[model samples]
Structures are given as structure tokens and as C-alpha cells.
Target: MKKKVFCVLIYLQFCFIFPKTSFPGFRAWLSPYRMALGGSGYLSFSPLTNRNNPASLKSKKTFYSGLIRYPSSIMGQGLAITLPKKERVVGLAVQHLSYGTFDGYDSESISTEKYSSSDTWINFYSSKRSTWDDLKYGFAISWFKSSLAQNQINAIVFSLGLQLYLKSIDANLGISLNNHGKVFSNSSNSSGEMPKETVISSSKKLKYLPMKIFFDGIFNSRYKLDNINFGGEAKINNDLEFVWGTSLNKISQNTRQSFWKSFFAASGIGLAYNINSIKIFYSSFFLGTGTLYNGVSFEINVI
Candidate 1:
């Protein structure tokens, strides 16, 4: 069918057109809602969805959101505030990841003082509807800072995205370039290039069911890595929803293990509840290495 052919062409383009390079940092999950949906939120309706696709930054109301994540000693958290201005929406977000405290040792492995490591990102983004009613575009600029003991590095990152709504299919399609930036450091050993990625994503609401399906194709040019993520969100009621999803990396990462084991290891699940103007979300997913991570977030509409 025509749909099948179009899908194949897109896959081929992602596989062959992207160049290989090292992976970039700052790919951490920021929203529990999107995380539960298998990390495929480029076309989500939620304003708090991943900012990697800046085109999704539209909301009729101003709101603030916060989230926290736990994966053993590594902790992650983020905060975001969004406001609509005329036909455009603008937002600010900050995220932090802490790698816990570790004992620093010299080359001789002698005892040393305890030290901590962390990464932080401060982002400013805006999006607006195109002259064409069905199109939207957005851009983001971020400042990144990372520290391990005394050594630290700073970087500037940029993201751009476009989204289109197909009225006939009742679906949304989006494309984005993320984490393209310059790294600054006095250290000679560190690479000065950012890990850049291209993402194509789509989402659809089934006509006969109270559910929405999502798909994302993410290509990392630096590392030559490609990931496909798919998931679904089912409405339990007007105020409650259940979500489940998985990615290709989760299914095939542990080839030595049983197929089902690897499949379950990569799966993610979560729930969302709305109480008046406040919404709460929770998500749980496993890393490729089988580590489990849990996150919770809260959003409140200010006006």
C-alpha cells in the first residue's frame, strides 16, 4: 500500500542519511508522562512533553511542572514553566542529574576525599503556529553545565522542530534536530562536539477506541545509533489514563537472555490522574542494562 511504501522510505532515509559520531550527553528523560509512553512524545498533546521537539510547546493556559527520578544512587529532577503569548508559546525549564557521592582515588588507588558529579541544563524555548493552520515550528537554546569534582565543562545546545497535522488521518507528524551545540572546556582531553540527533515522530488517536498510539524514530549521528520507540495510552476514564510502551533497544539489547525476558526488561508503564487544575504522573522503565528507573511528576495550571 502507499502507506507501507512511505514508511519504508522514511526508514531507509534514517538508516543511510545520518553520519556516525560520538553520542552526546543530556539525553535524560524529563517528563514522567512521556517516559511512560516509551519516550515517544514528539507528537503528544501535553504541553509538558519532552522539549526535545520544541514544536510541541503550545498550551492555552500557563502552568508549572516538576519531576523527580530515582535509579539507585543516581537522581534526576526537573522544573518547567510555560506561558502563552498571543499566538506563540514560550517556556523555561531546568533539569539536574546527580551521580551521587564517590570516593576519589589517585592513580595509586590510595584513599581520597569524597566527591560528587552532576549535570545541569537550563533551557529557553518558544513555538508558534505557522501561517498554514496545520503547521507549527519551534526552536530552543540551552546552556549545559557538568562537573565532576573540580573539573567542569560548559556547552550551548540548540534544537529546532517542525510539526504537521494531517486532517484526513487525524494524526500528527513531527521532525526535530536536537542537541546541536558547541562544547567549551579548558581540558584538552574532552571532545568539543555535541551529540546531535534527528528524530521523526508520529501519533494517532484510534477512531474506535479510547486510546492513542505513538511512534518515534531517533537517529544519533555521532554514535550512529538508531532507536525506534512505540507505545500506547489508554483512557480509563475522563480523569485517569494508563500507558505502556517499549523500544527496539530494550527488546534486543540482551540477546543472551530469553526473548520475553529482554522484551519485558525494556517495557515501561505509567499512570496519570487529573485533579481539578493539577495533574500527577508516574512512570517506570528499565534501562538497556536492566536497571529499573521510577519517576513522578506534578503539573499545575496557574491560570
Candidate 2:
């Protein structure tokens, strides 16, 4: 236990002290649950699960989740509310990321002031579940915004998702196309194309054990077959759970020459505690050799 705790501390230190920039394009920070589970949330039932696979939004209860990421001190919070009627279900979600302050530099590399960056997403979705076939389909319209030092970029995207549940096998298959939209405004830097991507994911529950496993395949328009992730959760009891997973695609060596040569890739472990209608989760993962990513989230169920 002592050794494990020490390892966790070391990882957090690494995350806090390392370089802090997410990969370009659709490779932003993920939710704690998704990151903990090896980047597989396509089949998850969490209200925030739709961030990755919009089709996974089948919850009847409204949910609020807040997460914090290390290294860059990125903070994210989201809310998902569902309205269920006899005919169909309508869901609305909002997610936002705020990157902490940074030292600004001039064209000549002179230190200036400090600046902060942020990103936000708003999604409106509708989902329908087929009673006979146990199939669900969801579609969403999303608006996204990214803010830098003095420029703000905004775009609108449409996403479609499908999910199938096999009760007899206790398994689910999910797929989604996310961030397909028009770029209304171009930023100061580059073209105005939203980071569009597709994800294929599945989850399975063991009949004889208290474990759930998930697998995901991610494809980005700019980088095809960028990531493959696998993860699992083991319930220790009614209130405690253990989670572990890893991303198969390693971080690029270009990010940090030294860090890339030391660690394998992205891998992490998490623990969750649930009490009544609220759950708290914590996870840590390797981003590169010396860079680590630590995340924590609090989720609550309302209604």
C-alpha cells in the first residue's frame, strides 16, 4: 500500500511539472471515466458519456459532472439533462474546458503577460429506443468554441450515433460520428475546420464476476486510426470500484524527446467511491516518459 501511494504521488508530480499542450486536432482532454477506462466511453451509461459517443445518452436521470486535468491545469465541467416522453427522449448537454494561465511571449521571444485559453461545447440531441430490437439511435447538433490569447474560433457540428444491446449476452456495441459541422469563422492561426472524428466501441459484463470491460477504436479525420483503447472496472463492493486501462497508440516522440523514449504509452488506474446519488472518481495515466495526466471527477444524479 505504501509503495502504491508513493507511485501515485510520483505520477502526479510528473504531470504537474511536465510540458502542457494537447495534441492538435481532435486530441483534447477526455473525461475522467473515459480516460480511466482506456479512452472507452462509447457504451458507458454516464450522462457525460455522450461526449465521446453521442448515442450513449440513454439515461433517464439528469447528471452533472466536473473534472480537472493536470499538467496544464485544465478544468472541465458538464451537465446532461434528459426529457423523457412516451414517444422519444430529448437530451441537452453542455461541456466546457478552461486551461489555466500561461506566460505569454512576444514575437521576439520576450516575456510579456499571462494568458488563459478555454473551450466550450453545447449539444442538443434526440434519442429513440426500439423496444423490439433493443436498439437505440441518437443524433446531436453541437456548437463549439475555442479561445486563445486574443482570438476565438466557433463552429457548429452534427453527429449521429447507434447502439445495440444484447441482453442475453450482456454486451453492448456502440458507434458514433462526432464533430461534423461547418466552420463559420476562421481563427487567427489556421483553417476553420472542427476536429471531426469517429469512434467504435463495445462493452461486456461477465456473468460470473463483478467486472466490466470496454474496448474502443478512434479515427480522426486528420489522423486515421489514431488510438485503440481497452479498459476494465472491478467492483469491490457497493461503494467502491477499481479501474484500469491503457491507450495502445503511444504519444508522439515529437512532443517530448526525452519523455517519449522512457514510458510505453498512455496507461492509468482509477478508484471510485459512490454514496447514494453521488460518485467521486480519480485516475492517473502516463502521457509520455516523464509526463503524466491525472484527473478527478465528481458526478451527481438529479431527478
Candidate 3:
């Protein structure tokens, strides 16, 4: 157990100390559960969390999930399906983001036709337990595409992840390297780079309370810590749970506001309900600019 822990720590240190060039796209949160957790879900077991950590694909049953975000000009949706095969699990997911139509203008400011822009991702992933039952490892390959009017770009990304289950502490620790790959563009206006991130996360179920807590750190290039998020899920009943989360970046951005307002800025709250083999989730997020967006998603278990 100690050796496993050490290995995870070493890997995290290496990733942080040796940063790589990172671009600026493909970092959007694809899962409602993750967004509701203030962008922290690297240690979660839900199939929707597969984009954050492929090692979370360890499950005995198959799962299918769909998500939609709205109330904003920029809309997004995602779909994920996971299948268990013998001792390993394989999954596929797709996420799409659409920017509202924009009016086109020429160099002389003449009005032209309206155009829309969008980004899409398709991911294939797999995971399995290591020699030790407590350790899990996984990898993922993603194809990404972005379009803006007549310009288009494509990229392929690769990710690797590791998760360790500490039975004694009833906690899970995970590390992941995501979006590490090259990009190609059909237009000269596009940059041939994609964003990369390193994440460290932990989740623990309280022994004395019917709750679980999560903490996650995200790092970008130049060894800079991009964000730190904290989230909690409390069981309200056998079939329902309350979820809430906040991030340091949000709080920092609203320091001039009221204490509570600043604290809740960029925060999120939601509820999850379970009925038979289906689970439903609803979430609302408070943007730093005071705008609010709601998301809904559902998952079904297929034996």
C-alpha cells in the first residue's frame, strides 16, 4: 500500500515539475456531474467522469449517460457509454459545444451571411486493475474537431491515468495526464496546439456521516496550479443526495464582492435521484459574472 501511494506521488511530482507546452482549447467541462462539482471528478466512479480519469471506468455493469447544458448562447451536450468485458472495462464518449450564430462582416464592414461555430470530441477509453487489486490504470484516445465558419481544425489527444484505492482509509487517490497530443488545421488561421492538463484528486467517504468529500488540483504549463476545487455529496435519503462545490479561482475573482457572494461565485449546487437502475441529476452553476446556467443529465444501468 505504501509503495503504491509513493508511486502515485512520484508521478504527480514528475508531471508538475516537468511541464509541457499547452494550448488553449479542449478544456471545457464535458460532464454535468463534474461541472456541479466545480470541475472536480477525477476520483469519481461515474461513467460521466471517464473524461476526467479513465481509471474510473472500473465497473461491473454497463452504463449509458446523456447530458445537456442550457440557458446560455453557448450550449453543450455529451453522451457516454461504458461496457464491462471480463476484468476490463471499455467506453466511448462524445461531447459537443455550439456557439450561437454570429453575423458576418467583410473588411469594409459590409453585412454578410450568419455563421455558427462549434467544437466536438470523440473519445475511446479502457481500464483494468493492475497486479494488485487495489490499483487501477487506464488510457484514452480522443479525436477533436473545431469549426468556425469556413475554418476548421482537427486534433488527436491521448491520456493516461492511475487510481489507488486505500481500503483502510476508505479513500481513493488518482492522478491523470490529459490532452497530450498534436493538432492539425486545414486553415492557416488555426494554431496547431491543444491544451494539456495534469490533475490530482482524492475522494473519501466519511465513516461517521453519510457523506463523501472530494478535493482536486489542476495544473497547467509552467508549473502553475490552475484551479483547486472542493465538493461534497450528502445523502438526504436512500434514494436522494445533495451536492455542492466551490473553487478557489471563483473566490479569487470575486474578492471585492460580499463575503458570501464572493464565496459562492462560480460555485454549483445540484441534486441526484436514483430510481431502480436509473439515476437523474440536476445542477445549477453561478458564474462569476452573476449569470446562471442549469444542466440536466441521466444515467441508466444495463445489466
Q: Pick by lDDT: which candidate is best?
A: 3
| TM-scores for every candidate against the unseen true structure | 0.85, 0.79, 0.86
Q: Candidate 2: lDDT of 190? A: 60
| Per-residue accuracy of model 1 over 199-289 as CA lDDT, tens digit each | 9989899999999999989987654547888999999998998998887766455644555557666578899898988878888876544
Ranking by TM-score: 3, 1, 2
As for candidate 1, its clashing pairs are 21-222, 21-223, 22-222
lDDT (CA) per prediction: 0.72, 0.68, 0.73
Question: lDDT of candidate 3?
Answer: 0.73
Q: How many backbone clashes does candidate 2 have?
A: 1
RMSD each, Å: 9.2, 6.7, 9.8
Per-residue CA lDDT of candidate 3, range 1-303, in tens? 343344334333323323343222254445677678876667775554334777877575655555545443456677788888888998888777765466778999998897766778888988999989999999989888878788887878898999999999999999988878777655736465456778888999999999999998988744478788889988999899888888876754574556666667878888999998898988887755455667788888887
- Cα misplacement distance, residue 203 of candidate 2 (Å): 1.2
In angstroms, give how far residue 63 of model 2 lies from its true place: 2.2
List candidate 1 stretches off by more than 4 Å: 1-25, 45-51, 62-64, 222-225, 255-260, 288-290
After superposition, candidate 2 runs with Cα above 4 Å error: 1-25, 45-51, 103-114, 187-189, 222-224, 251-264
